[model samples]
Target: MTTIEIDHTSRWFGNVVAVNDVSMTVGPGVTGLLGPNGAGKSTLINMMAGFLAPSTGKVTLDGKQIWRNEAVYRAIGIVPEREGMYDFLTGREFVVANAELHGLDAAAAGRALATVEMEYAQDRKIATYSKGMRQRVKMASALVHDPSVLLLDEPFNGMDPRQRMQLMELLRRMGAEGRTVLFSSHILEEVEQLASHIEVVVAGRHAASGDFRRIRRLMTDRPHRYTVRSSDDRALAAALIADPSTAGIEVDTTEGALLIQAVDFGRFTALLPQVARAHGIRLLTVSPSDESLESVFSYLVAA
Candidate 1:
């Protein structure tokens, strides 16, 4: 099985460091690179794809260095996040061109298009396709060479629900076949649905690495912040503060809402409605303020 290893790796753009001293091993099966924007995920992926060299340490595929190695491209396929594809070409022509670059033929291009379920629109110009169609065509081009390792950077950018599910199934099957599949995503739900193993990066540092459930528990166990609005704000806050689940409560006079921090997510969620009803406070709005992946990454970094 193909494996990519990053050992004590760091990438810097002159004075700015994009990736810090981080290390990880990506083997067979699907692994999700979980990180917020500008968290060095793209930089790390670039090094693995041999598009960018690490400033320090090494990034290798198997036992060979990946930097400046053109031979490694035979074993690695990359679906970049950016939309730099040729809009003038049809889907079939674009995939055929990618196959040709790898010394492949029309048969290889056809198989790749079929794998991504893009054959129906293969004759259509890329400019005429939707966002989801464009993504599928990009995926087809990457799979044209049938590489052992696949690296997808934000592969589900603008896909609809159906298209997203289709891609997930394709990746799942690829992983089951023992190909090393690594996809970077900031969306928790996307990663949770696709990858059981995840590596989290925060502020250019490796924050956590393990099973998704374990890391998810770590994130959820922390105090959750929420913005709560009710008819009787003072009464609701007072009632919620008295509960053991609530750690703190702040009255936001400017927003006319209560900022609450809950220690026990499950207990607090159940307690909120009960307390509001007891105090005869009509709940107007109750929304999580720190549910974003950035917030979760920040908590991991602080820990």
Candidate 2:
């Protein structure tokens, strides 16, 4: 399996730094690149695909320099995020052209289309295809060369639910085959479902990298803020504040709820219900106020 390494890599555009000093290794597996829009994910992927050079440090594939290296393309397949494909060409024609460019034949193109389950619509013009169909055709074109490393950017952007699941299954199978599959997406659920490993980027910086569940647990282990509404807010808050799990509590009169900060996630979750029941208070709502991925990532960056 081929491994892509970004060692102290940084890319800039004059005064604007797109990718900050980042170092990571992408090995064989389904790895998700998680970041917000304009977080320099595309820039990083460009450097990996040998389309853009880093301003500092190195991007290497199996110890070979990726920047200014055309030979690396033999082992790399890229599915770009933009929609600037050749619209006039049929899907089959498009894939065939890509195969030819890679010194491959029509059989390779046919196998790729079949792998993406797009052979049924391969004869149709790309202009007449739906967004998901176009995505599959693009995937077929990328896979025509049978590269070991596959890089996809926002691959599920316009796919329907079924289409999205189909593509996810395909990626899973590819990862199982030990192909180094790295995909960039801003959607948390997409990464959570498909990626065994994830790298998070925020504002051009590497925020976190690990198994999603482990990273999620790390995020949750921090101070947790919750909003709770109960039949007796004052009584509930009083009882909870006495517990060691709770660090602070405030009664928000405007919202008729208690804002609580808990230092221990597991202890607080178990303690809250028990405390409310003991005081004969019925809990109306118990919700984490800072459980969103964005909030979790922000907390991580702050730490």
Candidate 3:
């Protein structure tokens, strides 16, 4: 449908630089823009949606500029992260107004509501709707135009599990239809399950961009440090320390567990169970100390 390009773009706010000189391309398919809190992800999404301007570079849809460009709306539909949508209007009324803004009528509005499966509650006032309901209504308003590019910022912030799955499926279907769909999130599992492609950001800087598997491997390639408790700590540590895949290991006397720094994630994982079974050690608990996304992301960004 539409391709978006960000070229050496930078934005600032007085003394705080919001977005550094970063560049990337977002094309047809679901792309998860991932970053920690206050990492300028929302600022980047706003620029792409024509709601904000880059102070030092260009954000374009295909070849057309996205900033100060009202004509781009015909091809761009945005579901913003800000939770300030109209609360007085009913669902149907809100969607109808969105259609009217795009020079369409109520029929198109109704279809949009149906597409989001919100027709059943279309008559209810938005003021009484739940967070998830409000999210879906906002999605319907954005979909009313059937634009080529769809941009969503933190779209699943307050949604329940079922609502999250439904929205993910809808976005996947839209991407399959050749519509470019991009959403931002800080949750690693959400990005992993929803978007195969990922772009990671940290502290207003672009960290990594590629398939999720590559990123996952980069994060997992270093020694996977884990604390394990088993029936035989001494025996297990002795056996594991002999293996070349295990760089270092220590038996924690206070915690009564073994600290293992595994060099090869895949090899260590497979060797663990086999060694335990062969040595007749019943494992109590195995936990990775550095498995959190925050640490991984920080490492990637620092690199």
Q: Pick by TM-score: which candidate is best?
A: 1
lDDT of 2: 0.94
Candidate 2 residue lDDT tens string, 1-303: 899999999999999999999999999989999988888899999999999999999999999999888899999999999998999999999999999999999999999999999999999999999999999999999999999999999999989999999999999999999999999998888998999999989889999999999876776789999999999999998899888999999999999999999999999999998998889999999999988767777887887
Residue lDDT tens for model 3, 1-303: 689999999989898998999899999999999988888899999999988999999999998998999999999889987778788999999999999999999999998999899999999999999888899999999999898999999999989999999999999999889999999999878988888789888888889999998887887777689999999999999888878889999999999999999999999998998899999999998999988767778878765
Candidate 1's C-alpha runs over 4 A off are: 252-256
Model 1, range 201-264, lDDT digits (tens) per residue? Answer: 9889999999999988888889999999999999898888888999999999999999999999
Compared with the true structure, the alpha-carbon lDDT of candidate 3 equals 0.91
Query: All candidates' lDDT scores?
Result: 0.94, 0.94, 0.91
Superior candidate under lDDT, 1 versus 3? 1
- How far does residue 236 in candidate 1 sit from its true spot (Å)? 2.5
